[model samples]
Target: MTIDRSSMTALKVTLIGFAALASAMGVGRFAFTPLLPLMQAHAGLSLRQGAWLAGANYIGYLVGAMLCSMRVPATRHAVRYGLVAVALLTLGMGVTGRYDVWLVLRFGAGVASAYVLVGVSAWALPALAGHDRSVWSGWLFAGVGVGISLAGLLVLLAGARGYPPAASWLALGLASTAVAAIAWAPMRAAGASAAASAATQHAGRLSTDDWRLVLCYGTFGFGYIIPATFLPAMARDVIPDPAVFGWVWPVFGATAALSTVAVALGSSRMKSRRVWAIGQLVMAAGVLVPVLWPGIAALLVAAVCVGGTFVAMTVAGLQEARRIAGVNAARLMAAMTAAFALGQLAGPIVVALAATNGTRHAAGPSLLAVALLLAGAWALWRSPD
Candidate 1:
């Protein structure tokens, strides 16, 4: 059977969205995770300093999401230029050793990653639905996992070869450049259809259920970020072996990449909130594992549990928002994202403050995250669909 023009266009949009997300989220926002331990080893970067850097990126993410909520940047511009910005900022990290300079670069990268995510979703989702190819949206989000895994594996290989964090950063930067180039042309051809409609949505009035969804999504963000941010570093503390510890992130990313596809296929049978609640519950159990067991094995389990579910949670949360809000979904989604960003921003800060004398594991904060996640899951399950 021959594929029609709309089908080809939808496929192109999927490819563009995937490449953009991988660059923005994987290399731009999360490359830092795998590189963090290397920085600590080669650059004498302390855990507190790392936490600060993570916080800076999360702050920028919040700012970018807010900007998108306000519809400040055109969709195509955000996707096209945001990919370029992430590449440049990622490259800048390799060239700098100063702590302050690193903070600025990470912050800028966080903004660019958010722009690409929002822009691509807005641009591609409708285009796919119009083509009757909305099933590809799951693959679009899989870019995040693919990017994360690729970046982590690259750092793992580079670090094994005795390369410095700078080298890994530079390599990731170059890879991001290539990924950005793949998405460039298709993004240009994609129409700016979603931005205008999203701008006029009156999302100011939120019912109780809306508030619950926002808070639950925020809780998901806070619950997952601690391990997501520092798992490799934590694993290194147990094994001190890059080969073993390095696998954690790749496993995490691989699980995440597969989980979205699984959910997308199976989601027709279950309500989004139910899927979300179950995922969050599993994440809470995962977060609880390291706290209770305290070893590399537990952290790996945490990685699978958390990573497998975070993206699914994101997909479900957005779906729930759209279901509840209809045309107002854009504003609701923004509110949920801003809440999530705030939750992520708080995760690293809480870790920074809770850890004493450069310790990697903070049991108290982990337990707190577990509690929040469990509570969020319960809220999601109890809320009417």
Candidate 2:
């Protein structure tokens, strides 16, 4: 069956793509953010343990990204099962009692999320291009923010109701399953070929442009993830009120969703590298905010800045990879995703190392170091390769 781009079908597919991501990235990957505090409170989870769990998830993400990049056929099937796996692993967390189980679940969730991300990027992005709806491209990525907002609110509501952390994970998993089901059929119908991930050209040697894009992307990943992983936790230390600190994640997501849409609506004529560079600058400021101000207000400001810029930077970097790599974009996308995952993996370890006397405040210096790394990445972007 042929796809009808002339009708509303294309739009539906686009939104389904968004939902696919929301399920994979939003619920599967990020449900930890709002749930992190709950674990600390009820499960006696330490910050160091949490960092290890997060690191496990990131390592899984890197592995998943690398596997999906191997030019495997039937991406649609892989994604469908991955979505189901995300739903199941998330539900599994609620039922588990051991930290070992939690680590496994987080790692499984990471793998499922990466499969969806890579497969969806392959399927949806090209479809948008074929339909001349490339301007709506960023909306596909906006699912991350939407998922973050929803996960945050879920935790917030559960906290308000005095529900257990396990209950929150269970409820969110149930809801995410429903969303993933909606996305299942569309993606299954679109195969691996739809993604254009396989290279059509062989002049695939990495050019100067490719390396710079990859470097800046790695920085963006390292920079945004610190705040992404710990923003709500940081706020919890300052306010200690779940109700108040909970809003941080939602605000971050709202800003992310809006900024992603804004970037999408802007002219495609804007160069991807420029957007990537500007996003890094804003993200650095966000990472530095709490380091400088050290309060709820500063934390919220950081959330908005970091949330808003991360997804936009992601969109720009991948688009830049595609533009630079041409028909070989899949390999480049895989490379960038791997780099990003490595950066994500590094962030949690850095936080653990920075834990002065095993405290969050002691980690401030390391965060400041993260901000500086982002600044350095900005220089790499403009430097003549």
Backbone Cα, N, C clashes tallied per candidate: 0, 1
Off by over 4 Å in 2: 1-8, 192-203, 356-380, 383-385
Using all chains and alpha carbons, the TM-scores for the candidates as numbered come to: 0.94, 0.92
Instruction: Write candidate 1's Cα lDDT for 202-311 as tens digits.
Output: 64688899999989989998999999999998888888878788999999999999988888788779988999999999999888898889898999999999989988
What is each predicted model's overall lDDT from 0 to 1?
0.84, 0.77
Clashing pairs in 2: 122-195
Candidate 2 on 1-385: residue-level lDDT in tens?
A: 1334543355876787788788888888788977887788788888888888888899889888777655533457657888899999999988987999888999999988888777667556666776778778878888888988988998998876778899998987897788778767766556534533433433356677776666666777788778888888888888877889889999988888888889888746567677777788888888887876788999899999989988888787777776667667766777778778888888888777666533455356446546655664666567552
Candidate 1, residue 182: how far the Cα is off, in Å: 2.5
Candidate 1 residue-wise lDDT at 246 = 93
Poorest 10 consecutive residues by lDDT, candidate 1: 1-10
lDDT of 2 at 16: 79
Candidate 2, residue 357: Cα displacement in angstroms equals 5.2
Best by lDDT: 1
